[model samples]
Target: MSIHLFQISLTQLQGVGPQKAEELHALGISTVGDLIEYYPFRYEDYRVREMHEIKDGERITIQGTIASLPTMQRFGGKTRLICRVTVESMLVTAVWFNRAFLKEQLTPGREITLTGKWEQRRRQMTVADSEFPDKGGAKTGTLQPVYSVGGSLTQASIRKMINQALIQFGALIPEILPAELLEKHALLPRRSAITRIHRPENTLEGQEARRRMVYEELFLFQLKLQAYRATHMKQADGLVHPVNNEEIRQFVSRLPFELTGSQKQVINEILHDMKQPYVMNRLLQGDVGSGKTVVAAVGLYATVKAGHQGALMVPTEILAEQHTRSLGAMFEPYGIQVGLLTGSLTERKRRDLIASLQMGLLDIVVGTHALIQEDVYFRSLGLVITDEQHRFGVNQRSILRRKGMNPDVLTMTATPIPRTLAITVFGDMDVSTLRERPKGRKPIKTYSVKHNMMDRVLGFIRKEAEQGRQTFFICPLIEESEKLDVQNAIDLHMQLTHALPELAIGLLHGRMNAAEKEATMATYAAGETNVLVSTTVIEVGVDVPNATLMIVMDADRFGLSQLHQLRGRVGRGEHQSFCILIADPKSENGQERMKAMTDTDDGFEISRRDLEIRGPGEFFGTKQSGMPEFRLANLVNDFEVLEQARDDAAALTASESFWSSQSYKELRDNLNRDAKQQTEPLD
Candidate 1:
């Protein structure tokens, strides 16, 4: 049961020194266990066949002896190594290009095996691989694993390393999965799966082996997540807030706009969770301009009505100020006091705000991560809400939740999470989605155009500005990067100021201090600036109703999800909005992303395509979002396996037998070990 052997470094291997070990580590193989799990991306079948049975353009292996001495010939800087081999009583020419080193090995009457593409008409084989059979070459007519090797590594060298690992340590791999679970799924044992995956005799064996490994990875991952959910539920007792429907209805009636059906449904779900005995851990998903804030306001209102406080956390100070204004306007009718806290606030003002929160003088408070400061505390923190939830780390969310003893937590995001991630990354929390935008919202018209049409687009912008409408000019960077050819916000702002000298322009980017960002955004929001040139900082919470046009420079530089978010910024107003994407994408994938943006305005569809194109890691901005990088199991292609694993993990985690039985000891140990390594919260 000792894992000491598996924990040994790859440097212990015969030919692996520090440099070679570092290369293996780059492939996620630092230990023997890692080496065994480093499965090949593909396999080649080199079945020895008779020369008569070979067909044109087919890759075949033929065994023969050298009939004539190998000769090197040069023709106009192109070198060829040619030899005639005797195969099945016939002489067939074996050809290799730029392989002068093979001449020393191909001696007359020497026995060798050649594998290459065969051309029936030429009576020749273009040798792709050759082996000296009597000198411990691999057996003919067997499957060979083709690993994805890089940087001073070759296929044969990797094959050799894997073989050495299997021979020395494959059997020592502990079977941590419970026997019952393995039998129920008909999975191969850990040892056999590793061996078959690396050295399968046939395709079916390889596939089955892969299936076992994929399931094992997913099962272990889900076990940790589900265990966290179950353990937390058992340990924490949540506040039960009173739901006053008549009061909520009266508040909704006084609103300026009618709530969409999606909004009302989500409000009901959140309110329903609030009144429950346990704490609310729910995710609110809606596209940009889906009115999630109003629904969230109702929840805060309900909490305040129950004589408890509410807090909303956002990623940016500008968003906090915006939410405070909007929510303050809504809550004023009912005499609910809302306060704002931010890093930019003076020390005296911040102290006063903290004192107000501690004294229970404020009904609701909105702030940036400044809300999670060690000194910040709430007297009766009943419900916790986070806007742009993906921007905050799990630890930050957890810290905010800890401010209240089992407060109902409601997190909101404008980024539409794909279904695969909804089940994996957020499987532990209850989810409410707002698919329909509020009524009277028009679809944003999107276009992908080349740089040559910039003059025409600029003229259109001028006409729009003349009509008293505003524009948002988006750039990928704050300053022009030497490696990237995209326009920058500072230079763009200057250019627009000169070219359209009649219009007022304002620039905003991350490099600006918090007060500067707020002031610049304030000027644009108040109609003092006709164009706001900025980066993605405005992608989330800046809601300008009059801005009707969005011009994104070098649109191909952004991901599909990001492009969708940026597009969401302009279409908030009733005026017919247009999103102009300017770029000349060089890669096919880049071109496809641009095309997908122009084709549809649906956030969910865009997210699905984004998940497929850029994958889960980049889809969620994995580094900041804490999305796990899986090695074998793909959330998109292996969705069925993921679901099965999730269901099984949940069932097992919820079962009393799993907790009480000794048969599950090893599995329990694995779950505990994984829990120790996990820094992200279950939500």
Candidate 2:
């Protein structure tokens, strides 16, 4: 019978009551379809093996007959059950801790199988799981799926419920991938994949099932992105602006510094997109000091020269103000009116800025989220640029784009994203990368030290301050947290003030209001504060050329990309800058992160390692970074599969007949449904 598994309630399954249903819902399994798709994170190999064949320290499953009655021993707050089992004619001691109930089944001459780690010295086995041959739920000689359970649900219970759901509704599972696509990729049918993934007879079968799921996930994601691009191009209301090449060239020539080759090429790409019949959707990626701002200014200048307006949205007010000052000075000679609109603006100032934008009096407006306010309107907003694109959600990007008539959008990020993520997360937009740093920028020297070196680090900072340089002391937390052992900005600032009272110290964090943060940053930027103790709030877009020192406390608490970003805050000028990571991390991952910081100053390399260590989920807050959470696909390890899937998705989206054909109706419907469910950006 035909059915929609998604519409069937998980509570309808046997033994799943309201409480259990609520628990499952918390795990993102509310419907029967979600339950079936809830694949296991790993599996247990319980295939029976002979004791003599098993290697020392190897975890193996052995079938045997009970050779002796079980004996129980009580200890301090713990109990142990010991029994002798004859495995392949050899007697081995099986031990189970705190499992007193197992004694009832460990009778003499009873046949059973035990899976555990074997110690050859004592010929003893630490039984992790045991099952009798006559048991109903025996998982012997198979790969048992292990799921990630939460609340009161055990792995056994989850597995049981999944089995029940599959047995009852397996026939209703529809194939999401088209038949031709599946055959081309050699993917299993959806129903078979679901079944084998949950209960595979062997490791190879399980891997094949996992491969199918990974490809399906990546393909579906790419399809949505491609479809979004297609829909936008089809409804293209883009304006074809006349290119004033001479004027733009003159503006570029007027700059004090010469443009690099990469910058010039990227500018050509942006300018070319502007002249196209379709709206330009581009992502500009650059390292922290790679001169992305200059390239963005050129794009904005092109829009203004065409008698249109532009708006740049940043994550923080301080960055917006910094951009306003720098861009305003650069455009002053060119007669371009640039305005700043932030939440900290006074009422009269905000009103006047809004009026100027609406009247086309402002050529380029740089602001925070305040630019997307309801009262703000632009007369001819032709270009929209967002700095630190990962900071904003997809919906926020769409909202800002909606402010204009299908404006050519340019999103910029200083965070060096790996090539794999760049293609998948932003498959909808064209990409422009600037790898070459601006001329004459020095590499920042980095070091990792323990907490005991704080005194020496402080002495070095004092010397730097004496040499007429600034320093930034970054903490992970704004306020003191009892649960965490890391340094807090407030306490660090206080201690530093006492330790180095001679140097002027200032505090900055996210807890402060926008106005206060702006004021604090202004003082630090203007050299009034020689030492600024702040949190990660100053992680991005806070450019201080004279600041030659960066000290990060508890650096292990941060990801590699973040540590790199913090390090990038310095090394902006020609001076020999330094970044000291103060962390005594115990975990191997943390140690690797610290070592990575001291090894290289390359942002791209650090980001690649970050993806490998933290995976894609924590690459940059997956929810906010616009990265989809795939069940079986890994952006780092499964790059090849992802590439193939992307190619197939591109081919499928380019076919107009495929979308309209009756054979592909189900796939089209699924695509539309997925699109409606997500809050994806239009541009």
Task: Please give, for residues 237-308, the per-residue lDDT of candidate 1 as tens digits.
Answer: 899898889999999999999999999899999999898888889999998889999999999999999999
Q: Tens digits of per-residue lDDT for model 2 on 620-662?
A: 7855545677778888988888888878888888898767888
Cα RMSD of all models vs. native, in order, equals: 4.4, 4.0
lDDT of 2: 0.88
Structural RMSD, model 1: 4.4
TM-score of each: 0.85, 0.86
- State how far residue 87 of model 1 sits from its true place (Å): 10
- Candidate closest to the true structure, highest TM-score: 2
